[model samples]
Structures are given as structure tokens and as C-alpha cells.
Target chain A: DVKVTQSSRYLVKRTGEKVFLECVQDMDHENMFWYRQDPGLGLRLIYFSYDVKMKEKGDIPEGYSVSREKKERFSLILESASTNQTSMYLCASSAGTSGTQETQYFGPGTRLLVL
Target chain B: AQSVSQHNHHVILSEAASLELGCNYSYGGTVNLFWYVQYPGQHLQLLLKYFSGDPLVKGIKGFEAEFIKSKFSFNLRKPSVQWSDTAEYFCAVNALSNYQLIWGAGTKLIIKP
Candidate 1:
């Protein structure tokens, strides 16, 4: 069984504060993703990393950045948190060799509240 | 723009009632369809997926979905839903040539006991 774990399950931060959310996967998957889930808006991708130090922007990547210094860990960084950035953050990983048909395993998600 | 659409946003059904949720995608290429379920506080998990071969695919916990290429639809169905089946269902599509998966807004299903 694959295990994806997040650093925090819930977080609260003041406006303009810097925030970091971490995710780690034990499956050694090469592809990792960061997404923010909001009601009615669905899951909007923030950024994705295909390999160490390799990052790609998704549909919505504004105000957010990601780091993949190691294969097992992926970190999402908010330059300066705003109330609008409050959302449920999700991290997922999939086998890189597999095509788009590969199934992505997800973490439990971190609910961030920007005050 | 390519995207996935789930018709129902919220659905309430009694236990033992038959269930069906509609999902449609707007992509004109070979695609992989998926239905994912998120229980109350649990992480999202794959309910079913359709890549090729059989259009009718069965997944965990007695859930199933059918892919209709002509309609560009992949609708999920269950014979009888239990209270434990209450969850938020999301429809996602992955175009063969694209790395990102287009996702639907999701349907929140509440099963009454």
C-alpha cells in the first residue's frame, strides 16, 4: 500500500504571513503534485514536479511556489498568505513511467485558514 | 478548454435505493476516465477507472461506472447504496497526450439510513 503523509492536517496563519505545507510519499513515485480544493471550484493544480528540481505550473499557480529538493518530499510555499488562499491543500503522487492513465495516490489533505 | 463536468452537485438517497451519478467530459481525444470518492474525513481514493477494452468497469465497494465514447460520458452507478456509501464523488479525465487531469466540481452524495 502506498502512503502519502502531509506535515499538517490543519493550519492557521495571519494575512501576509509566509506558510509552508509539506508532503512526503513512501512509494518512491517520481511525479508529485500540489492542489488547492475549494467548494464549487474543484481541485485547481498549483504546481507539479516530475523530478528533483523540476517544476511545472498548473492551471492556477499564482501566489504559490513549490520545492522538490528530494524525491520523497514536496513542499508548497505561499509567498505571503492571504484570506483568499485559505483552502484544503492536497498532495498527490503517481508513478512517473506510467502514462496519464496512472492512478494518483493522495494525502489526507491540510485545511489552511488564512486570517 | 478541456474539462470534466459532473451534473449533480448534491444528491440525497435512502439506504437500499439505486444510485446513478452523471459525468461528462469535453475532450476530443483518447482519454482515461476516473471516479474518485472522499468519505467524511478520509483522503480521496479511486472508486473506478476506465482506460480501454470494457466500457463497463467495476470498482471497490460494489461501485461501477460505464464509459460511452459517443456521448463523451462516464457515469457512475450502484445497485443499492448503503449509509456508508455517503461521500463526495469526483469525476476526472486525463487526455492521453496531457499530463494534467481535468476534474469536475464533484457531487456530494448523502445516503439516509
Candidate 2:
């Protein structure tokens, strides 16, 4: 069984504060993703890392950044937390093998509340 | 713009009831479709996927989905649902580029005993 772990299951931050959400996957997957889940909006991707030090912006990348310094860990950074940023954050990882249907394994989400 | 649509937002049924959820994508090219379920206090997990070959694909927990090319639809179904099957279901499409997925708003299913 693949295990994807997140650093925090719940977090609270004030406006203008910096926040970091960490994720680690044990399946040796090469692709990792960050998404924010909001009601009526669905899961909107924030960023994705296909390899170490490589990152791509997703549909909703404003005010967010990501780090992938190692293969097993991926981090999502909130430059300046705001009340609108309060939502559930999810991290997922895939095998990244080409020509194959890769299923993403998700971590227990972190519900962040920005005050 | 590529988008996935799930018509039913909330559904409630009794146990042993047949279940069917509608999912449609707006894209005219080859695509990969998936159905994901998120139980209470759990992360999203794949219930079924449709890539190619046969339109009907079965997945874990006796769940299945059928892909209709002409209609651009991939609807999920189950012959009988249990109380444990109560969860939120999301339909997603991999189109436009890369591994990025376009997700639907999701349907919350509640089963009564």
C-alpha cells in the first residue's frame, strides 16, 4: 500500500503570515501535486512538480508556490495568507511513467484556516 | 476551455438501492476519465477509470463506469449500494495537456440504513 503523509492535518494562520504545508510519499513516485478543495469550486490545482527542482503552475497558482528539493517530499508555500485562502489542501503523487495510466495517491488533507 | 460536469450535486438513497451518477466532459479529443471517491475524513481515492478499449470498466468496491464517446460522457454506476458506500464522488478528465485534471464539482451521496 502506498502512503502519502502530510505535515499538518489542521492549521491556523493570521492574515499576512507565511504558511508551509509539507507532504511526503513513500511510493517513490516522481510526480507530486498540490490542490485546494473548496465547496462548489471543486479541487483546483495550485502547483505540480514532475521532478526535483521542476515546478509548474496550475489553474489556481496565484499567491502560492511549491518546493521539491527531494524526490520524496513536496512543500506548498503560502506567500501571504488571507481569509480567502482558508480551505482544505491535498497532496497527491503519481508514478510518472509514460504511456501508462497513473493513479494519484492522496494524503490526508490539511484544513487551513486563515484569520 | 476544458471542463468536467457532474449534474447531480447531492443524492440520498436507501441501502440496496441502485446508484447511477452522471458525468460529462466538454472535450472533443482523446481523453482519460476517472471517478474518485472521498469518504468522511479520508482523502480522495480512485473508484474507476476509463482510458480506452471497452467502454465499460469495473473498479474497486463493485463500482463501474461506462464511457460513451459520442456523448462525451462517463457515468458511474453500481448495482447495489450499501450504507458504507456513502461518500462524495468526483469525476475528472485528463485533457488539454499533461497530467492536469479538470474536475467536476462533485456529488455527495448519502445512504440511509
Candidate 3:
């Protein structure tokens, strides 16, 4: 069984504060992703890392950045938290050749609120 | 750019009812598809995936999906839905050049017992 763990299940931050959401996978997957899910908006990809220290922007990258210091860890950072940035953040990891759509395991998700 | 669409936003059904959720994608070329389920207060789990070969793929919890290339659709279905089957179903697509996934808005299923 693959386990994807997130640092916090819920978080509340003040406006203009920095927020970091961490995710770790036990499966040693090569590809990791960060997404923010909102009602009616679905899961919008924020960033992805294919390898260590490598990153790619997804559809919505503004106000968000990612860190992949190691294979097992992926962190999403909001430089300055805003009310609009409050959302359900999700982290997922997938391994092996992706051409054939491998299962991307997801963490429990961190629901953040900016006040 | 690839995009996925789920026509059904919220569905309510009685127990033992048949279920089907529609998902459509806009990408003419080769692509991979997947279905995921998120239970209440739980993480998203892989229900089924379609890369190639057989179009009809069975998944956990008696759920299945059919991939229709001509229609550019991957619709999830189940013969008899249980109350436990209630969850938010998301359909996703992956294009060749980009390994990232394009996701649908998702369908929230509610089963009444």
C-alpha cells in the first residue's frame, strides 16, 4: 500500500503570512504534484516536480511555489497568504513510466484558511 | 492544451440504483484517462484508469468505466450502488507531451438509503 502524508490536516493563517504545506510519500515516486481544490473550480495544478530540485508550473502557479529538496518530500509554499488563497491543498505522487497512466496516490489534503 | 469536463455536478440516487457519471475530454490525439474517488473526510483514491487495450475497466468497490475514443469520453458506471459508494468522482486526462493531469470539476454522488 502507498501512503502519502501531509503535514497538516487543517491550518489557519493571517493575511500576508507565509504558509507551507508539506507532503511525503513512502513509495519513492518520481513525480510529485501540488494542487488546490475549490468548489466548482476543481483541482487546479499549482506545480509539479519530476525530479529532485526540478519543477514545472501547472495551470495556476501564481502566488504559489514548490520545493522538492528530496524525492520523498514535496512542499507547497504561499509566499504571502491571502483570503483568496485559502483552499483545500492536495499532494499526489506517481512513479514509473507515466505514458500509461499510473495511479497517482494522494494525501489526505490540507484545508487552509486565511483570515 | 487538454481539458476535462464532467457534465454531472451533483447526483442523488437511492440504494441499489444504477449509476453513471459522464466525463468528456477535449484532446484529439493520444491520451490517458483516469477516475478517482474521494470519500468524505478522506483522501482521493484511484478507482480506475484507462491507458490502452480494453476500453471497459473494472475498479474497486464494484465501480467501472468505459473509454470511448470516438466520443472522447470516459464515463464511470456501477450496476448496484451502495450507500458507501457515495463520494466525489473526478475524471482526469493526461496528454502526451505533458505528464501533468487535466482534471474535471468532479461529480458529487449522494446515495440515499
Candidate 4:
């Protein structure tokens, strides 16, 4: 079985603070993704990394960035956290061998509250 | 633009009732379809997926979904739903060679015991 773990399950931060959410996968997958999930909005991709030091912006990447210094770890960084950024953050990893048909395994989401 | 559409936002049903959730995509080409479920306080999990070969695919928890290429739809179905089946269902699609998956708004299913 594949295991994806997040650094924090719940977090609270003041406005304008810098926040970091970490994710690690044991499956040695080559693709990692960060997404924010909101009610009615579903999951919006923040950023994705295909390889170490390689990153790509998704549909909604404003105010957020990502780091992939290692294959197992991917981190999501909020440059300046705002109340609008308060939502559930999800991290997913997938084996890139199958192209777009690959199934992504997800971690327990980090619910961030920006006050 | 590639997109996914779920017909219902919320669905309330009693236990043992039949279930059917509609999902459609607006992509023209070979695509992969998926239905994911999020139970209360649980991480999102894949319920079923359709890539090719069989149009009808069965998944865990007695859930199944059928892909209709002509209709551009992959609707989830269950003969009988339990109270434990209550969860938020999301439909997603990804076209061939695309890196991102287009997602639907999701349907919150509440099964009454």
C-alpha cells in the first residue's frame, strides 16, 4: 500500500504570516501535487512538481508556491497567508509512468485557518 | 477548456435505496475518468476509474460506474446504499497527455438510516 503523510493536520496562523505545509510519500512517485479544497469549489491545483526542482503552476497558483528538494518530500509555501487562503490543503503523489491515467494517492489533508 | 460537471450538488436518500450520481466531461479526445469519495474526516480516496477496455467498472464498497463515450459521461451507481456510504463524491477527468485533472464541484451524498 502507498502512504502519503502530511506534516500537520490542522494549523492556525495570523494574516500575512508565512506558512509551510509538508507532504511525504513512501511510494517513490515522480509526480507530486498541491491543491486547496473549498466547499463548492472542489479541489483547485496550486502547484505540481514532476521531478526534483521542477515545478509547474496550475489553475490557481497565486500567493502560493512549492518546493521539491527531494523525491519523497514536497512542500507548499504561502508567501503571505491571508484569510482567503484558509482551507483544506491536500497533497497527492502519482507514478508518472502511466501518463494522465495514473491514479494519485492522497494524504490526510491539512486544514489551515488564517485569521 | 477541459472541465467536469456533476449534475447534483446534494443528494439525500434512505438506506437500501438505489444510488446514481451523474458526471460528465467537456473534453474531446481520449480521456480517463475517475470518481473519488471523501468520507467524513477522511482523506479523499478513489472509488472507481475508467481508462479503457470495459465500459463498466466496479470498485470497492460495492460501488460501480459506467463510461459512455458518446455521452461523455461516467455516472456512478450502487444497487443499495448504506448510512456509512454518506460522503462527498467528486468526478474528475484528464485528457491524454494532460498533466492536470479537471474536477467537478462534487456531490454530497447523505444516506439516512
Candidate 5:
């Protein structure tokens, strides 16, 4: 089965601290995405990578950045974590190209708490 | 702009009761639709998806959705819901531009035994 994994299930970070959230997928998919889930707000894309060393900004990329040095791993970075940034982070991967195999599979997610 | 909307903020149903969750999208052109579920503390799982052909799509756990193009709606339904079905469900959309999904706020469903 295809598996997507995130490094943390729960994370606590002090305000103004830099935070890193890591995600890895075993499917060797070409597209990886980062999203944040919040109460009353649907999942908002933070960043996405279509290929190794390639990245694109999603709708809500403000205050966030991402890295995809390798095809299977994608990292989301918070330059300066803030209370408002505390939310559930999800990582997803899919076959970057078109065709019937474009469904995205997601990791369990990381719940981040900034205080 | 392109976006998705889930009308129900919350819903409560008894086990064996019918279920329906409304999802609408503002994007008119070619688009992909999806329904996803998140059981507390678990990752979001795809309930179903609609790409081309047959507007009606069935997914795991007996969940089904109909994509009404004229209405711009994709509503999820299950003939009978179970207590185990309690979770938050999301409606998502991505224009033909690729897989950049725009998600709805989500509906919290609580099924009572």
C-alpha cells in the first residue's frame, strides 16, 4: 500500500521560533503538497512540489516556505512560528503527471501548538 | 475566484438514518470534485472522487455523491449511517489546471447509537 508519513504527530513550539515539519511518501510520487487545517477553515495549501527541486506557492503560502530536495520528502518551514500558525498540518503526495493515477494520498498530519 | 463550499457546519443523525452533505463549487470550467473524511486524530481519507463520465460516484463505506453540473453541486449521501461514521467530511475542488485542490470548510457529522 502507498504510505505517507509525517515526522511528528504533535508539536509544541515557542512563539517566534523556527519550525520544521517533515513528510515522506513511499509511493515515489512526483507531486507533494503541504496544507494546514483549522477550525471552520478547510484545508489550505501552504506549498506544493511537482518534482524534486521544484516548488510552487499555494493560495495560503504567506509566512510559510517549503523544501523538496528529494522526490519522496517534502518539508514545510515556518520562518517564525506564531500563535496564529498553530494548526493541523497535512502532507500529501500524488503522481504529478496526468491520467487516472492522480489521486492524492495524505499523511496522518501534525498538530502544531505555538505558545 | 475558484472555491468550494460545504453548507452544513454540523449534523447529527441516529444510526441507520439517511445522510446527506451538500458541497458546492464556484469554478465553472472543467474541474475535479472530491469528498474526504477525517476521523478524529486520523488523516483525511478520500471518500470519493469525480473526474469524467457518470456524474454519480460511489465511494468507500457506502457513501455516494452526485455531481450536478448545472447546479454546481456535489452532495454526499449514504442510505444508512452508522455511529462509526462520526467524523468531519470535506468537499474539495481542483480546476483542470491540475491537482491544486480548493477545499470546503467541512461538515461535522455526529452519529448517535
Candidate 6:
């Protein structure tokens, strides 16, 4: 079985504060992704990493950045939290080819609030 | 760019009701389809996926989906839904060219007791 764990289930931060959301996957998957899920807007991709130290910007990469220093860990960074950035953040990992195939396993998600 | 669309935003059904949730994608080339469910306060789980062959795919919890290439649709269905089946369903598509997944807005299913 694959397990994806997040550092926090819930978090609260004041505006301008820096915030970090961490995700660790037990499986040695080669791909990891960060997304923010908003009601009505669905899950918008924030960033993704195909391998350690490599990253790609997704559809909604603004106000967020990601780091994958290790194959098992992916970190999402909010340089300065803002009220609008409050949302349910999710992390997922997948193996196999880079595109068009593979099932992604997801973490429980972190609900972040920027006050 | 690839995109996905889910027909219903919210659906209410009594237990034992048959279920069908519509999903469609827009892309010119071959694509992979997936249906994922998220129970209240729980992480997302795969319901079913269609990559190739046997258009109909069955998944955990008795959920299934059919991929219709001509229609560009992949709809999820269940014979008889239970109260525990209540969850938000998301339909996603992956274009063969890239790793990016185009997602639908999602459909919230509520099964009454």
C-alpha cells in the first residue's frame, strides 16, 4: 500500500507570514504534485516535481512555490500568506511514465487559513 | 489546452438509487480518464480509471465508469448507492503529451438514508 502523509491537518497563519506545507510518500514514486482545492473552482495545480531538485509550474502557481530536495519529500511554500491563499491544499505522488498514465496516491490534505 | 467538465454540481439521491455522474473531456489526441471520490473529511480515493481497452472499468466500493471515445465522455455509475457512498466525485483527464491533469469542478453526491 502507498501512504502519503502531510505535516499538518490544519494551520492558521497571519497575513505576510511564511508558511510551509510538507508531504512525504512512502512509495518511491517519481512524480509529486501540489494543488489547492477551492469550492466551485475544483483543484487547481500549484506546482509539481518530476524528480528530486526538479520542478514545474502548474496552472495556479502564483503565490506559491515548491521544493523536492528528496525523492520521498515535497514541500509547498507560501512566501507570504494572504487571506486569499486560504484553501485546502493537497499533495499527490505517482509512478510510471511522466504523462498519460499512472495512478496518483494523495495525502489527507492540509486546510490552511490565512487571517 | 485540455479541459474536463462534470455535468452536475450537486446530486441528492436516496439509498438504493441507481447512480450516474457525467464527465467529459476536450482534447484532440488520446487521453486517460479517471474518477476520484472524496468522502467528508477524508482524502481523495480512486473510484475507477480508463486508459485503454474494455471501455468499462470497475473500481472499489462497487463504483464503475465507462469511457466513450466518440462522445469524449466517461461517466461513473453504481447500481444501488448507499448512505456511505456520499462523497464528492471528480473527473480528470490526462493528455498523452504532458503530465498535467486537467480536472473537472467536481460533483457532490449526497445519498439519503
Worst ten-residue run, lDDT, model 1 chain A? A36-45
Clashes of each: 0, 0, 0, 0, 0, 0
**Which pairs clash in the backbone of model 4?**
none
Instruction: Name the TM-score of candidate 4.
Output: 0.98
Model 3 misplaced stretches (Cα beyond 4 Å):
none
Question: Candidate 4: which stretches are off by over 4 Å?
Answer: none
For B1-113, candidate 2 gives per-residue lDDT tens digits of 89999999999999999999999999898999999999998889999887889999999999999999999999999999999999999999997357898889999999999
Candidate 1: where are CA atoms >4 Å away?
none
Q: Which ranges in model 2 have alpha carbons more than 4 Å from their true place?
A: none
Candidate 6 lDDT over residue span B1-113, tens digit each: 67898999999999999999999888978999999899998889888888888999999999999999999999999999999999999999998788888889999999999
Per DockQ, the best of the predicted structures is 1
Better of 2 and 5 by lDDT: 2
Per-residue alpha-carbon lDDT of candidate 1 for residues A36-107, written as tens digits (9 for 90 to 100): 999987788899999999999999999999999999999999999999999999999998987888899999
* Candidate with more favorable, higher DockQ: 1 or 3: 1
Per-residue lDDT of A105 in model 5: 89
lDDT of 2 at B87: 95
- Colliding residue pairs in candidate 6: none
Candidate 2 interface RMSD, angstroms, 1 decimal? 1.9
Is model 3 an incorrect, acceptable, medium or high docking prediction?
Answer: medium
Per-residue lDDT of model 4, residues A19-115, tens digit only: 9999999999999999999999889999999999999999999999899999999999999999999999999999989898889899999999999
Q: What is the TM-score of each candidate against the true structure?
A: 0.99, 0.98, 0.97, 0.98, 0.97, 0.97
* Pairs of residues at least 3 apart in sequence or in different chains that clash in candidate 2: none
| Per-residue accuracy of model 6 over A25-83 as CA lDDT, tens digit each | 99899999999999987888999999999999999998998989999999999999999
Candidate 2 chain A TM-score vs. reference chain A: 0.97
What global local distance difference test value does model 4 have? 0.95
